[model samples]
Target: MLRTVSVLVDARDRAEALVRGHEERLEAVAGQSRRRPRPRVYTEEWDEPLITGMRWMSVLVRIACSDDVFPEPARQPAAKYRIVTPEAVLACRPEVILAS
Candidate 1:
């Protein structure tokens, strides 16, 4: 069991590093283009966890608005959801995903 856990942890770290590298490549590509400032992504999963309401909504909004990269949602409120189910949460959507 411990061995399995360690292997999984190592895999997760590798995946995160890959994602970060991809993002960096994307940023470089964007910079090379004549496009305006880069856009920010909400990058959330639709699930019950987000719906449970643990003040995440407030935090996301606050962080987005304060961040120059992330723009406000098109409509009055954002419709994106967060993964709450144990299975979904363990799906490894985040490098350091957190749930309550």
Candidate 2:
């Protein structure tokens, strides 16, 4: 998630203007890169992911899924870890809203 955020902040261009403005440069870099330094980003949702230089990301699931993962009450869990159910996640609605 952090990596996604970093990409959103650094790599993604909001306006078509940048692409339009760099039409010549875009053509120049059709496949090849100039090997230039990009923006430095430090994001943390789980970990970070890189665009050009490097990236880091965490692979994890949350909450609990299946009695096997969490086990029922006193029962010993058979699985090593549990995964978060999408429904549990979706249960919480966003508290904030944004307007233009």
Candidate 3:
């Protein structure tokens, strides 16, 4: 069981790193964009059953198109993820919501 856990952790780290690398390359090529404000984004990993927000070290890594709504989470590293209520999400006034 320990071995399996270790392997999964290793794999998750590698995947996160790979994604970060790709994001870095894309950012480099894109360079800085206009000063216009970026939209606040709320992405959901799951719906119907329950609502959860994406929270991890990787969330700090910007993507080409996606923008994060909550800034506090990005500053938090030790935290993995958390469940959010609909009211909380609404309070953010996210310009975009990615639900799956």
Candidate 4:
């Protein structure tokens, strides 16, 4: 029917407009600087207890578990355990602390 066709056409026009808006936003973001801001240097000395506390340990654990920090192996079983290294933990410290 003509009415049904008109409704479908209107729906498509709205969808196309939404897609265009998304594409424009993506392009604008892509045009900006791609460089990551430098991590802040810590001037104040951290207390030994605070650094070794449960809260700090939890933050390190969360960062270690992130996919960016350690990419998951392809076709690996979900139940398989991956051992996190001390080096990896040290490397991601700045990112975790600065939240960059």
Query: Candidate 4, residue 93: CA error in Å?
Result: 5.4
Give the range of the ten consecutive residues with the poorest summed lDDT in model 1.
Answer: 67-76
- Taking all chains together, each candidate's TM-score versus the true structure is 0.26, 0.15, 0.49, 0.33
Residue-wise C-alpha lDDT for candidate 1, range 57-76, written one tens digit per residue: 33443333322111222222
Q: Give the best candidate by TM-score.
A: 3
**Which ranges in model 1 have alpha carbons more than 4 Å from their true place?**
1-9, 35-71, 75-77, 80-100
Ranking by lDDT: 3, 1, 4, 2
Clashing pairs in 2: 48-56, 49-55, 49-56, 50-54, 50-55
Selected candidate, larger lDDT, 3 vs 4: 3
- Residue-level lDDT tens digits of model 4 in 10-96: 776666667779768655654442343433221111232112213333333333332223323212333133333446446656353
Taking all chains together, the TM-score of candidate 3 against the true structure is 0.49
Question: Best candidate per lDDT, number?
Answer: 3
Q: State the displacement of the C-alpha of residue 42, model 1, in Å, after optimal TM-score superposition.
A: 16
Q: lDDT: which is higher, 1 or 2?
A: 1
Give each prediction's root-mean-square deviation over alpha carbons: 13.6, 19.1, 7.2, 12.8
- Quote the lDDT for 98 in model 4: 21
lDDT of each: 0.40, 0.27, 0.58, 0.38
